[model samples]
Target: MASPVDTPRNSPSPSPEPDNPYPVETVLTVPKFKRGWAKGARMAFFEARVPDYTSARAKGPAQTADYLVAVSNAYCQQFTWWLDPPNEPTASDLAKTDDELDPAELQLKAAKILRLRRASRNLLDRLSNSAPAISKMTPAQIKRDPVSSLISAIANGKTHVPRARTAYQLWSKSQFNKDIKTDVDQSVIDNGVDAKSGRIRLVTGSTQQAFQNLPASERRVWELQADAEKAANQEARGLQKKDGVIPAMPLDPTATQDMLDALVHKIDPLLQGISKLTNGNAHFYWAGPEPRRGGQINVISMHAGVDRMPIPCGFMEAGGSEGVARRRTVEAAIGDFALSCYDPKVQAARTLPKIAPCSAPPSFLRYRPTTWDAGNTESPSAHSQPSTDNGLISPPDVSLPGNPTTSSNQSPSATTSKKSSKKRKSNTDAAAPPAKRHATGVRTNTNDEDQTSDDEPEETPWQVDDDGSGEDEPANSQPRRSGTRTSMRISTKTLPPQHDPLDDITNTVHMSSSDKLPSPEIPDNVAGAQLTDDDTMNEGLDTLNAPTTPATASTPVSTAPFLSNPTIPADLPKYLTHVLPKFETLAEPAWQDVTKSFVKYEVSRKFDDVRLQTGNRPAAAVQWSRLRRPLITPDKLPREMPQTVKLAAEAFWRWWRHLQPSWRNVNASANALGDIDRNITEEDWERLDASGANGLVNVMGYLWLWGMKVGVSGEGCQDWEAALRDVQWALEKMTAATNV
Candidate 1:
């Protein structure tokens, strides 16, 4: 219901009143917006007509927002999903105002930059057409927010990722080299090296002396690693040498802030593309010592999944204290990566699934102890074996000459009575093996036991004693060579109680006067104790086998002592009827050296034994000679060896001269000596592979023999003696072609 005054007021136009009224309220009709008006058919037609206008509207701040969401989310995922918090930059890292950075923090920044680079690239690629507004955004600007700041607190941290990695690698590598160099120094220090040359000295003469000496493996590995580290260090040193690049050593902990900053600035871009293939997850480490016992800390995305644990790479012998020694011992015990997968036996018998080619080796394919979580205990140290020091075995007394003959009954000093005492003194002074012979070059034989003898006490020509009763001769005195020979007390055994020579002579006279001393006892203990009945008969049968020593200085001695097993027995004439015409050839000094060396080494004794065992076959005699040569000639003796001892030296010389071409390639030329009944076939060669064939064995044997003949003997070459001792080792590993 309308009021009367209101009724008139209610009309479309209202009138004014004297006291209380105003003008009329108007209602105007306005054009309406259509349903879905902003997105209407007319607007759609306009948008379609002008594609650029629609495109401009679509590419607005909303695209920027989407990009921020995508890039931010990607980086966040990278940080949260990939890196555990411990590996991330911490409050301490953010507080580090100095240019000097914690390696971990630098690593974190590098990882973050990697994430940003990856995310930004991905975003730019995806938003190329519709989200052109994304071009306005940069990871540099976006990383400043609290969320992005969690990954990298410092501004421009994203830019440093690559350089940080390179610097880190360089720093770590430099440190590794330093440690390795220290280890090398320690090795040389603990195990003394030669003063004149740098080769390791033989400190002990145990049967297993090879282990006591610098192990060949350790030497080889250290040499290689040291060379590499030295090269890298030199390169870094070269870089540091650059003017204004660094004010001090690059590795100095307190290097100038500017230098450090410059370093970071210089290095960042170089490593930017390091893991482009692996998405920044392809990192390596070289860790050791406390906190990094498993080796240098690093993270890499392994094939199975992400890895964030310390990885053990190669074993490094700290070679330091008990603790360090324990660590090295442990590393050696369980850490050597013997790739069993490649072994034929293991491959044939394995029940496990095959390893993936893309994944890590078996040594690194297992889970490692992680440092990220709390309550994790450090790995326990390995239990160490008890150690002891035995008398340090060195080479057999090099100061004294070996017995001239294998006959233990005869004193070698007696034979040298006429020689100048100066010759003996010269020989004694030159005790050490000559440098040319002591070369520690690699050899085919690696077995340690055979390198030196511990089985029997070495047979010395005579024992030295300082019984005060016997007056010592002055250094310049014309001392008997025999008396001087026993003056060097080489063995560690305590000397027997001193005796008065007058008392001994009086006692000897009393004993001799009381009873004729039991027909000059022929003790069985002496070498060449007595000629066996068979040996005597053999000698008597070969009446022309006796050796004749020439008076020339080149002759080893004026006469070959009656060593029991001489190739030409004492009773046998030197000129054999089998080859009597060749007797003139035996006059050479080379033959004298060969004959003396053979007698000294007891080779003729061994030759007779082999000849008897292998049958009276003349071919067997030649085979025995081949076997004996290497045994006798590790340090090649000055003389050339005769082909066989069964024949007279002249006869063998004649045969050797005739058969030079046939025996040139020792292995290829000689027929198989031991087990070969037929010619080797192609299949035998294939099966043998690099293990060595009949020909190889023969050639090595021949060369070994030749080396003994020509290699410097006496104290001139210790390596030769070592080689001689290793004959059994060679025979064990490289036997005659058998089971063919």
Candidate 2:
């Protein structure tokens, strides 16, 4: 997904709209930052409605050059300031601003702004004059050109271009390789192989073999050293460490001349792949400082094609953990983007399949019984039996609601006999104990013989009893006649109720007495078989009228109102306790006044500390005495203020009250009545003289009190308490200071 920062709010159209009066005016908006510019820029340049190459070419070289210069200037202005403002400019000073400013500062700022414009013009002229030759030249030819590199740096912030020569230098001078050479030379010397006497060859014969057969412990040490070196190298390359593992280089070989040559050979194909993907319009370059941290290689476009603005295609990390699973390079990142554009199947293959909200019904519900055997017309037994295939009671054969019986399945006489059989079976089941009743199947009773009687109306299957049981048999239900065959048949359409209707019917049967039948055990596999039509209809109605759960004590609630208990803390100072409850209902304007007064009180305290440290120096003593009056006058305060400021003010009051005894003791020592002031240092006095002590103390006290009230703990509360302690210690030390 693309972020809002990367997408352009408004894009330009190639041709004017039918209602638009002007046709030539075209406007494009680009983001000021480059963090999410890759994906956004690609959408703006390629996906947006813009003119084709033929239309752009018709504008001619002169118009194109002017457009390039305008875009380049706009890009440069975001990061660069063209003019320096004069310092301390008054009405009179503004008239002579040039004379007041340093000449060197003016020249440096002007040169940078002009440099970008000049390079852009130079690039246009170079391309226009050598159009045919430039078209034939490879990507290497354009990259090596000075103009291409200069414009790329200005437009897309591409600073570093990787080279095979640089890679070779990095490997040759690496500390790990130097250590390996040292170990090989030391091994040869320890083995009594005299190289100076020419007794044994040192370069490749015995010494090389000894280096290859290094011990397991020594090899492990080298591997650890290599990992450390790789981490440091990646840090220098501006890549972040992932999962505590530094990204590995494309080719990492042990310290050997042969391995080093192979490492250089592997890099050539990677560089070529990057060049081929970008062609000549853009270059794959590292976009950051020379020794930058936390950055990646980006494919920066030069705006040489149909694109009006210089945009990056995408970026990729330089290295990953060494092995079969290496991180993607710049070539792969660009290739993926290109393939997604050309191949529709690639995107289709990556998309996840959609899933249904609810799962399919169980296999038992899908079971449809075959037609009954006509040759042997034996009636079903007294109770319905469970099917061997699935652990569910076989449903009785009956016509479903809104579904008429077909001639092929039922004859006129056969239909009447089935209805009579169901009516008799329902009465027998109702009289039987609930323990014997099957809980997984729904039973429906129908009687055509009862329909003719006007006095007792025929009962419908949808009717519910007075006790809310839908299983109540008709009031005129009859017992089964002897030798009557009852063929049990289940309708494949309707499902059973969630709670057994038989339980409710059994409870209705014994309503007068407290005794009830025990529920029959159901098989674990067919537990869901009891979801009948009546339960489903009731559930649908309940869903429409269901009430939502209300908020409970365990749920998190907002504390924005700043309401708290009326009772004040016992440790709180008596002078401020009366005003503590007012903070809960404080207004915004009065809270600002309290903050200002607290700042003044803190400033006054600093001056008083300076007076004690200077041994009653007249200048310091006068300043302290002047500012001491009206320092947080409690009676003059407003009726209400913010709770945070109130807590902070109260803390300052308590802290001052606590320091009173120490202040008196320090004052006595300074008057030559004690030796406490003798231990004070000049550094302690200097620290006390620093400003902003008032704001620091106020903030720390507020945080400490707020954390306690809100039940904040862990490192967060500990940090605030630690800061408060440091402030208290500093103030105590200031009180004990003597003349310097």
- Highest-lDDT candidate: 2
Each prediction's whole-model lDDT (CA): 0.25, 0.27
lDDT of 1 by residue, 1-740 (tens): 10011112212233345442222232332233223322223233222222222222234533332233333333333333223222343444444442454555433543343343334433333322232212222555444333333222112122111122232233334343453434544565687765224522321222123322556775465456556656665655454344212112122211222222222222222223344434542222111111111111112111111234353111111111111122222222232222221343332232222421111222111111111011112212111111001101111100101111122211112111222112132232244423221111111111212222343343332323332222223332342343223232323353223222122221111110001111111111111111001011111212112211111101122223323334543332111110111111234344334334433222222222111111011222233232211122132221224333222222222222222222222221112222131222222322112221111222233333443333333232333333333332222222223322
* Model 1 lDDT on a 0 to 1 scale: 0.25
TM-score of every model versus the real structure: 0.14, 0.17
Error of 2 at 202 (Å): 11
Give RMSD to native, each candidate.
Answer: 40.4, 31.2
Candidate 2 wrong stretches, greater than 4 Å: 1-147, 150-557, 560-720, 725-740
* Residue 673 in candidate 2, Cα distance off native in Å: 26
Question: Tens digit of lDDT per residue, candidate 2, span 1-740?
Answer: 10001101111223324442122222332223222222323223221111211122234543333344333433333222323211122344333333454666444433443443344344434333333323433576455564533333222212222222222223334433454556656766688666444333444344345444767776566556556666655563554122221222322111111222222222223344455576632222221100011111112211111123242111110110110001111222232234234233332332223411121121111111221122113324211111211112222222221122232332122233223333222423344334321222222222323222333323322121222112333222355445332233333222223222122221111110001111111111111111111111111222112212211101112221211213211222111111222221233333333433333333334423121121111111122121211111222221122233333333333332222334232321111122343343343344233223122232322432333332322223333333334344444454344322
